[model samples]
Target: MAKVQVTSADKTKINTYTFFLVSRMDAGKKYYVVSELEHLTLEADSSKVSRDGQFVGKLVPESGYELPQNITIEYGSDVQKVSGNLYSSVTGEINLKASWHMLIRAKGVKASDFFVADHVKYQITSSENVAVVGTDVEDNATWTVTDCIIPATVSKDGKNYQVTELGEEAFIGCKKLKSITLPAGLTTIGERCFAGCVSTLTEMHCLNPVPAAFPQLFFHDTMEELNNSSPVYDCVLYVPAGSKAQYAQAEGWKNFGGILEDGEIIEPVVGETTDSTMTITCNAFEQATGYIVKVYEDAAKTRLKDEYQFDADGKLRSSSFSFTIKGLSAGQTYYIETMAVREGYYPTPIIISQNTIEAKTTGTATANEGVTADKPIVCVQDGEVVVRSSGEISVRIYDLSGQSIVAGKVTGYGSFQLTKGMYIVVAGDESYKVVIR
Candidate 1:
């Protein structure tokens, strides 16, 4: 698809009888003709046959058909083709028919109307700009991801579109998304864009320095599922550092929890590694818009292995959801760290040599710290809070309203009874969810 700007001046300045070539090609060599513009209206002409036996209307129209040059049919028995304009030929007194394809000002189509870039759909805003329409569920690689970032520009077919706005219900029903970051250049957000991502979302990052306008029911169903006291519940909104005050007064953003600046929220754990390649994962840093991985030549972190950190575009090297460091000597012990990346936030520098956390697998009701071990200092066992240790270990349980139900210091073993419900069991600096049913 092609995006062109047209104005009153274009009516006289541009080619009038010229054929507008707006074509698209896919990997399988299937071709399509789709064109959309701001001030221009493209109407294709597909009537007569060409000189070298090629049919007219060489390209298929967005809302019409492509017909071969000549076709013989019963004159008035089964003619079903109808268009804005029709033409027929008479061959030996037998009526011959041909179909024509033309697309006028496209106000009826949406998906095939424009183009997609970087697995996100875009609606043409102008000759030079496009707005995010929605996530491409069929082509998107981040559907199960918890954190997704919408960039300022996306490239497709050797062209780039400035993403300035987000259409209504853009991310609706994206259930796996726990957080998403909007680019700084974005000026508008539509209604229910974040719907269906309810209690799972712990944070949202809006990089726009100025608050974007929205409808009154923009977060209608979304806020109803969150724990916000007013317009938002337990969801935290992270805005730019200096723009927090402006967002505090903005209608669409003011009522969320903790409108704060960016901070460190990554917990990196090393995963499958080879001589030159490795994967670094984190335990759900909800505030992270992106991630950055750096490799070091020395364990002390003095010399950086910059070759492995960025790509040709100067962007951080990353795979889908993790960092994979390549091009290393097979047996060398190089150090690496993956930090939670955002627009204006920098996490504390991590030393791979000092990292002790292992690869994590998040679950619905487990809040474990450190390596998994069977030592029952505190655990849930069949509707009872169990605590056992060689020395005295503090054990406590709380209800939903932070009401302490069990408070005790125990040695060897101790058990507290509870009915069928949910409780937060705490032991030292670690806490785990125990549900009795």
Candidate 2:
């Protein structure tokens, strides 16, 4: 068994804690599973201050070893009423300023300290021991490596520890992860470390030149979409310069569709466009803090006409990305270019051809506030159209044949009963289509 050490940081940050659980599953062989214990605490002016010490319930033990579930916690002196998870509680979704934190414990196993970075969890077994990168506490769309640390390290109680390896099933069932950047000091990648990331993962970077040896089925599939449906999968591996041949010969590392030197930048995909706006979205570059969308008047891309910036903590937003460039002339053809800007990486230029819609000369004045296309606070209930906003709103209903079914003004909350099929409800400038069943 691997020797484990407990540090004071382990208990202090238990609300956002990370630790390892030694799960003994029937056989004498022992397995280790990383546990990220989450709990919410009330805050006074942004600092966490504790209340009473009432035990809620022990974290679902490692014997079950399931995905972490939310534990309810209360604030102030209201122990009778509790809020749900950290996100919901903090955001007032649960109508409370208090949130729950994680509680993790094992009956007979040694506990160790852990920390988190870039949404990835790391358990510290020894301050000087081999660094082991743990799995993510929650699923994410995209993830980036920590700030270019050779041995990803964390400081707690005035001491620093290195994160040097990937734990077992570190990224299993991360269906939305589209891109990743591996650390430099990593020496071992456990089995199924990148499994079930089939939906959108298309590229990754390995900073280590002669680094970790990957275990069997490092990128295997556990999700149904990849296991029984799609057979085609492609991923590009970018390694350090002059080490492409070394990685090509390494087991499991050669499975990528292509390997390249780490400095090349790829183009982003172009999405929807409007008369005055065009949406360009892309995966985050290895260490980029944000992306710059540059619009050009010509295909040469040398002349920059307009630019927009999107910042997302150095990772792609939602494993997908999108940002609109507004103020372009309508009915005009424009060239689009994207540059993923990073601290230490070269910004590569990506180009796309785009055409704006014809400018609207005269129509109902559109309101950009309150409502949005495809999502509106209006809904039909009790045979009436319920406007959810507190302000006055003008609404128009159109049928499939472009015939007007109803038009009216609603204030505070108003409703109109209408038989349903497929109808487009126009509120302000936003139009919502509904199929009444």
Candidate 3:
């Protein structure tokens, strides 16, 4: 057996004021010193949080070129050693050194402190990045965060940090979150950050006009409608001025149906028009609200001609309503406005200008001269004629001209291929005008 000798250096005895052995891990016998370092520990929620600083061995004063001997600690069968003096500091002290400390936080340690706003938890990192950590269950609702701590950074218990990203599942299962105003400086949103928040989340106000890089499933399992490309149903993404086009082209960001700029609410779209009727579609914030569609004869939209309201009981969030205004003059320009009404609040109204098609009556023609007026109902589906009445019925399809092209009999449901054009379909005494495209 060989005996071992141990020697230690104390900087305090030399009146060096304060000595710090910056610790670093190395594989060889060479030791290094560092000034400052950071370490993260995995939390129970699977998030990473920084740990408090630790103390390293004391630093020894520089002697001749002959390097000082290494120090080793022995405990039963385990042995550990730390190195110092990497690159010398300008002050003649070894600021960078090798550390034997495990760096990783041990179990039973409390998590880091975080700020709370509108029931949501946010942790600020040393790099000035914000990370959404968690939220309080009892205070779930549509939260609007106007601004975060001023100066972008805050100090708590002598620790300084800033906000930058979102942790995984930050808003998961927050079903009552009707909307959220994201703070600026957010660069990344972890996977599933908004998962399970689909039920009531209808609006997202992103202060960061530039689209941030989002990971897979960022909106996964949310209430929004999902398509092959993305899951952006019923929600609106509001960005800064002149940023609509940028967001519209970014992946995930483009999926939002309504990507409007701040202060720009999308007006209702006019869909499907006829000589006497026109359909107007509008989006709403929540279900159970009342919707009103008003038509005006003048461009000012002050003179109301007709008013249409959806059955209040039929209102639903994450859906659109199409209202048709009938008894209107053909080939006439009209001004339209849509309003969403709730019990306690009055939402902004949207206005648009529309025109009705010119009115025309079909010329009288006799295809089945004896056919009665009560003919089977007919419709077009997938470029084919579908007879939606019981029993076989005589079917005659004619082009825009009185010329009869196909004369046949279809029972129950039937399909037929016709050129992409307007045609008059006659079943018994009934006639239907359909377009195939």
- Give TM per candidate: 0.37, 0.36, 0.37
For candidate 1, lDDT tens digit of each residue in 6-36? 2233421232222223443311222122223
Clashing pairs in 1: 227-233, 227-234, 228-232, 228-233, 228-234
**Which tens-of-lDDT digit does each residue in 1-437 have in candidate 3?**
11111122332221111222223431122221222111211111101111112222332233222111223332235554322222111112221122332221111112344566545565654554546666644333343432222233445566655656776556655666666777567777766667655444667888887888855566564334233323544466678767778888998887654566664332354445555666665555342246666778876667778887654465435455566667766555666666554332113322111122111111222111111123444555456766644467888889888899789887655678887777788877777676564
Q: Model-by-model lDDT, in order?
A: 0.49, 0.48, 0.48
> Arrange candidates by lDDT, highest first: which order?
1, 3, 2
Model 3 score (lDDT): 0.48
Q: Better model by lDDT, 2 or 3?
A: 3
Off by over 4 Å in 1: 1-106, 110-113, 138-142, 221-230, 264-437
Q: So what's the TM-score on candidate 2?
A: 0.36
Return the number of clashes found in candidate 1: 5
lDDT of 1: 0.49
